[model samples]
Target chain A: MFFIGWLVIIKNQKGKSWIKLVESKEIIEIFFHGRGGQTAITASQLLAEMAYEKGFIDTIAIPIIGAERRGAPIMAFTKISEKKQIRTYDSVKEPDYMIIFDTSLLDIPRIKDTIKEGVIIIANSPIPIDTTDFPDNVKIYIVDATGICIKREFMHSSGPILNIPMLGAFGKVTGYYDLEIMEKVLKKEFGEKKVEKNMIVATDAYESVKEV
Target chain B: MSKARKDFTQEQETKIIKGNVSAAYAAKSARVQVIGAYPITPQTTVVEKLSEFVDSGSMPGTQYIKVESEHSAMASMVGASMTGTRTFTATSGQGLFYMNEMLHWATGTRLPIVTAIASRGPAPPWNIWADFTDVISQRDTGWMCSFCATHQEIYDEILMSYKVCEDYEILLPKFVAYGGFILSHTSKPVIIEDQEAVDNYLPPLPDEKGWPHIFMDPERPMMFGNLIMPSGFYSEFRLKIHDAHMKAKEKIKNAAKEFEKSFGRNYGNGLTQQYKMNDAEVGMLIYGDLALQMEEAVDLVREEGYKVGMVKLRYFRPFPVEDIINIAKSVKVLGVMDRATAFGSPTGGPVSSEVKTAIEGVEKTAKILPMIGGLGGREVTLEQQTEQLKILIKMNETGDAPGDLFHGTLWHGKLEVE
Candidate 1:
């Protein structure tokens, strides 16, 4: 009887640890691939802020540091979790979601090879991507963020400020955050004067984003 | 120099800010009188935020001096600190190396100046990444050095530092350091305490008498750090500085207790924080940002039925010898992990070497494993930490060291080179 009770205790302990692991493993790891001055790094931070505002308990945005020039490919990451604190500072190697600011970057082997099976890709392109080369379980979504940025005249010196629209389409695709949380975080970060134009691009991308 | 006493009656607010910004907020909350500014990557944002605070008139009557070099930054801070006002500055990597000259001056003069260091790796390879070698290299500079593992600690430690440094018995400058980019760039939610609470906790700003020993009054004027003959009190002054640092251990513990009483946060006796060590046969001793992550590793390892625990060495200067010996008694195997190198030293790692020296004369049963990793901002993942704990457990059970023991140290996480 004592051995049977001990086995039951060990089973209960194992069950609890397994549940804790699973709950902590629900963290959403996202990778952003963009050219320099495309606002991808800022988008990583803004996404963490948005998720936190939307009630995620823990979030971290990591921007890769390097000597980046205009049009040079750069990468950033955001890890958002609801329960556990994000402890690791390493870059996301197996991202659950990938965001591409420029569709042409898809040609880069380094960026292309990172998209694995069961991963979702959100691209800022006018039309859908040709996913014939991608794995069967991979899903790709496209939104004309540049068109929306131009329509709303939301641009900086280099190019369209694609972070808001990209983040908007991301919110639509993942349902992790919504328009309300975006507006709340944007108003806090970018101030009231710039919120109108930002929301214009953000809403357009939200409504137009479609899975290919 | 004569300005009204600012009534900082604002309510405390919690913000999700980067660790560098948290350092800026701590300075602002302390109402520091003089700030020496120089910009360097990672450490740049800290001075930038403080400049914003000064420019917006939010921090009234604060003199923000723009310096051309890190040397001038520390020199100007020394000038201001001599005038009996609270002074603060920050630097990183090459900038810290540049300020090494004044680092000695601040301690020799015995001013209670507080400087935050977003620690980065030494160069020659031109890298600006998280490594503690920049600050640890200054171990002989006579400044009390403390490592912070969390964003909130970055703020709280600075506040407590001023409290301990300004004590009449312990008028010593201190460096509060954290991993560059790891803590400096990462954003986390931190609670900024109300100004009233801070004012009650910290000692009042120094007056015309300046420090207890030195005075900067022009009328009763005096020259400081003047030329001392070799046969003079130079050695005596050095011995005095050493003595003060040795006595600061008690003052730090008292300040930490008072801070917890006032701010309601515990820092584990202000020297070392133990996690899950109640019934552990093996444990790891680490510091800086890695220590926080090690807590998660300890929890995961304990769930696997291994009695694994961790101890975070907070203060490196005072060495925490008593705490080290006490913690050494609890576990059979202890791993001393350093994120900085002390190349050519006994253990090749600064903290582990110190730990070995700390336990030399003590009667202890624990076998010490000296380990080093995360240099030059190398990534130390949670999975790797779990595996490290398993290695410690294996070594304890088998009475054999793990593989890749280079010169009596396990340099974990090195890339496979042909």
Candidate 2:
């Protein structure tokens, strides 16, 4: 069973490592902008909740905008720290990292506000973007995640399943949580074989960032 | 290279593909009992795939419904979803527009159904491609819209969407878009996760007993869509959908999170998708295929030393009014791009329509220009987009409106009336 394997991974890896951290570097806020069915808010909550179970302290996931009607832009956020209390229930103001489920959103306003200094930006676009004009402090990472995902044939119709690889890279770079922790959760959630594929993408993203 | 590695397990490879087709397979795999379909380009492939599944017996215990029109398709799903059966439906372009009336009924009654929509431009000569105007045009309809940027997102979203829509807190219906050409014609390897993985990701519906909890009791019988007097009619009707909509926001979020915990993939929450705008001075707002082009266009401008960004309106219905206002507040100028035109208006574009409304409440003056492009599947070029960006940036610096209806294609050289 996928769930059983996941539990084993979680138990064997850290037993209960993610128990809310007392305090960490800073709060990592990531904003997902996609339609109702796209799993915008769910992505944050699932990552946060599962991490919470592992013992990560002050981890929170919440959606900041819109009614959950289909075809609307749903915004969900995740915050992790070692601190005991995360006072704010509000949405992310200056996200340390931002993921663009739709590259087209690069044209929309305010998506820019989510990014802060040294933010890692991932987008699902077909072509590579020239981020030369980006602020000196900001590091832009643009991937044809959709194009690459399609090429890999790992994508399904409803939406991009690329988030796994995206998350894989996110976990590797940020150390927000252990990649093994994610691997364990994924195995528990997705099963062993699926978890293996996700790990590959995650590792690929992790390696790709170093070249940049 | 120090740590030992496991042999990689590759994702499944498939033949030709489209986002709608992926969505269809998801619904079929989810064991949807009834699929109500109305033919429309882009969206047509989803129903076609489902029919194939039903014909091939790949999906057991499923009824493939071929409805007369989009309206009937929605009407059918509304009835089917209300009757405690997992239901599915799809439409696009004018087909979705035609289904407008039924959409209201589905959400008003709090039906937890799922529909796949292809965002295509509206009619005149009748061309088939993708555009967000069709979906964005219906921003007030009350359904939760999920825009799929890639086929994988489309697949995961379809399953997750069902879970979210069915939440008792969010009894409203959901609309999932495959983003026309970007996803519809695109083919790639899709990791067909074990059926059990999907099962674990999405739990059984809460109303397992049967059907949604509607006020339908044939014994004593209650009125459904009967005439309402001016006394308390609007308020009663308004509050019901309003309560459902608000509850749906939280419900959908929780359900999405649950799906994420079960599945390794997750979609974040928001009324819209935000791209690189943290340090941007000007923002471009768009949807569907056009948004894809604009995304590239912004990068081109960034190369030219302009701080440009974008937001794709994924959730069209229950328009993210406050979110838009907040987005608008951060920027000096905003370029609202609409593939469909609403004639005789100040901006003459669907995107400009609501954006103008949202900007009105803000303090700073946002130079809002409504530019209509890519009508009837007309190819919008990068150069034209670059020109629009130049104008938008200028407007951002100096609040002046340069009245231009269509920026690219044949409209560029044509003289405009003062």
Calculate the i-RMS of every candidate, to one decimal place: 6.7, 21.1
In the range A89-190, model 1's lDDT, one tens digit per residue, is: 777877889999997888877778888777889999998876757766888899999999888888899999999999999999999999999999999998
Shift in Å, residue B177, candidate 1: 1.0
Tens-place lDDT per residue, model 1, B1-418, is: 3343444444687777889999999998888989999999879999999999999888888899999999999999899988888999999989988999999999999988899999999997877889999999999989999999998999999999999999878889999999998889877778899987888897567676546455577777677989998999999999999999989999999999999999999999999999988899999999999999899888877877899999999999878999999888889999999999999999999999998888998886589999999999998887668777877999999999987699999988788779
How would you class the docking of model 1?
Answer: acceptable
Candidate 2, superposed: residue stretches over 4 Å from native: A1-212, B1-16, B97-100, B136-140, B178-182, B188-193, B208-212, B215-234, B252-268, B344-346, B397-399, B403-418
lDDT of 1 at B394: 91
Candidate 1 chain B, which ten residues in sequence have the lowest lDDT sum? Answer: B1-10
How do the residues B16-122 of candidate 2 rate in per-residue lDDT, one tens digit apiece? Answer: 23466688878865667788977777677788888988887777667778888889998998877665667888888888888999998987777878888777767
DockQ of each: 0.29, 0.02
